[model samples]
Target: MEHYHDRRLVEQTWGSSNAYTGSNYTDYPYFPTLAKQLLPNLRCVQVVEWAPMSDNVYNDGWDLKLKTPDGDGAATAAVASSQLADTSLDCMFVYFDAVDLAGHSSGFSPQNPSYMQALENVDVHVGTVLNALYARPNYANENWLILVITDHGGIGTGHGGITYEERHIWWIGSGSAVAKQQITGPDPGTYNLLGTGIFNQSGVDQAKLKQSPVQADIAVTALHHLIYETGINPETYPFWVGLDGKSWLSQFSGVDKDMERNNIKVFPNPTTGIVTAWFENPTNDHVTATMLDVSGKVVAQHNECSSTNKITLDVSGQPKGMYVLQIKIGEQLLTRKVELK
Candidate 1:
C-alpha cells in the first residue's frame, strides 16, 4: 500500500516526472482534499474519483470508478449515465480530463475552432449525465447540488499565474437550493467556489455568511458542508485551519457583529494547541468561550466568572482541522479562526 501510494504521486501529475529532478516528486504527508476527506468517513457515501490503479478512489474508501477510455468525456458520461439509475448510490463525481489536455495542446480560446469543438463535445456529454440524473428514480425526492467548474483558465497559448485571464473563470451551479438570481460583476476568488456551491446547497444564515478573502477558505467551507450533510461532529478528529482564508460562516458572522466593539483578541492563532483569548473591558460581566467546528458544532466550552477577562482552551489532543472560537461577554459575541495542527 505504501509503495503504491508513493508511485501515485508521480503518475497523477501532468507529466511523467518532475522537470528539475527527472524523477517523481516527493510524496509528502498532507491533508486530504475536501471531497476525499469528508466522503470516505460518511456512512453510505458514494464517491467516484477517476484515476489509475495507484490513484484509485476505492483505495481511499470511495465506492466506485468509471472505466472510461483515456481522456474520453463521452465514454465517462455514458458510464456515469448508466449508473445514475442505481438507487443505492448517494453521490457522484464525473470528471472530463480530455478538455484540459485539449486546452493545453491548443490555445484555450473561444475563438479557437478546436477548442470550441472540444467544449461542444463536453456539452453533449454533460447533457447525457444530466439526463441520467433526471432519470433517477429518486430525482423527485432528492436535493441535488450540481456544480460545474474549471481548475483555471489560460493566457495566450499557456496557463498558470494569477492574471485576470488566468484567475477569472466561470462556475455554474444548478440545484433546488441555488439562488434564482445571477451574481453580477462580483469578483469572487477561486477559493470561494466550492464554499459558494456548498452555501447554495446547504444554507448558512445569510446574515451570518461572510465572504472569505483567502484561498484556503475553501477548506473551511468544505468542512461546513460536510458537517451539514453528514451530521458528524468534527471535534472528535483533528482540527483544520485554512492557511489564509477568512472564516466565511459563524466565526466571521460573530466577528462582523463585534468588530466595532473591539472587545476580544485571539493570539498565537494557527497554534498547535494552547490558545489564549482575552477580552479588553467588561469587568463585571460573565463571559463564555465556546470552540466550534466549521459545521457550528460545539467542540468545547469554558465559562468565566464576572471578574475574569481572559479564557484559555487547550486543543492539543483534538484532530487537525479548522475551528471557530466564539467568545461571549455579556451581550457581545466575538469570534475568530483557530487552527489546531
Candidate 2:
C-alpha cells in the first residue's frame, strides 16, 4: 500500500523516466489564473490546505483536526465567508476533499468512531472558522454570503454518482448578503456535479449572485464572473479556456432555469467488447461517429444513418485502457471517455 501510494507520487511527482518533465500537474496553469481572478492586483492570497487528520493519532487518515489554521473546514470557510476582516481582496474559493476521501476509504459509515468523529471535527472546524469571521470587524454587516459545499458528494454503498444519498449533499449560508433567499428552479440535467454542496456566496448581494443549474460549468463560470466583476480581461489568463468543460462562458449568461443537454451518449462505457453511440436532439444534422485509439489512429468509422440516432460498434478486440469516442453532429462535436474491457 505504501509503495502503491509512493509510486503514484513518483509517477506524478518526478514524472515518467522518459518524460521531458512537462509541467507538473501542480503547474496546471489555472492556479495562477485563479489567483489573478480572486486577488487581481492584490497580494497575500494565502491558501492554507489540510487533508485527513484525526482526534486520535492512531489512524492518521481519519483525523480531522490539526495544530493550526489549516484543515478542509478552515479552507472552506476562508473561501466561502472569511475573505478578510476588511474585504481588502476580491473573493475566495475553498476545497474540501477530506470527506470525499473518508467516504472513499471508509464508506461513510459511523461504524468507526473516526468516521463520526471526522464529521464532528469538520463541524467544529467550520464553527471555529465562522467564529473567526464573526469575531472580526465588518463580517456581521451581512455584506458577506458564505457558501459551504462538498466538491462532489461521494458514493453511497461504496460507489459514487448522483444517487439519492450520494447526490444529496449540503448547502448553508448566513450573513447580510443572503437573508431568506431561496433558490427554486428546474433540475440541472444529466451532469454529475449537480447536488453535492450547500453554500452561500457571502460578501456579496444575494440579488446579484448568479444561479447555475449545471455545476460542471462552475470553473469557467466563476472565472468569467470574476473577470467581469473584477474588471479583468480573460485573454490575459492562459488557462481560462481549458478551465471549464466548454469555452463559451458567456453562453450560459442568462438566468434561463431550464438545463438540458441531450446531444450525445456513449453507452456501456466499460464495454466488454461492444458499445453503441447515440445522438439526442443535436443542434446540427449530418452526424458522424468515430472510434480512435490512444495513438490517434482511427480504429473504426461509421457514416451514421440519418434516421437512427444510434450506432453500434464491435470494440471487443480493442485493448484495455482509455480511448476517445467522438461524435460529430453538424458543426457541433463532443468527446466522451470510453473504457474497453
Q: Among these predicted structures, which one has the highest TM-score?
A: 1
Off by over 4 Å in 1: 1-60, 184-226, 229-238, 243-341
Per-model TM against the reference: 0.50, 0.39
Per-residue C-alpha lDDT of model 1 across residues 117-217, encoded as one tens digit per residue: 87888888889999999989879997665656554566666554435565455645566655554434334443222222211413222222233222233
What is candidate 2's lDDT per residue for 24-86, written digit by digit as tens?
A: 233232322344533335322323343221221121111122223444465466554444454
- TM-score, candidate 1, is 0.50
Off by over 4 Å in 2: 1-39, 44-89, 109-114, 138-143, 156-164, 172-175, 189-341
Q: Hey, what RMSD does candidate 1 come out at?
A: 11.6
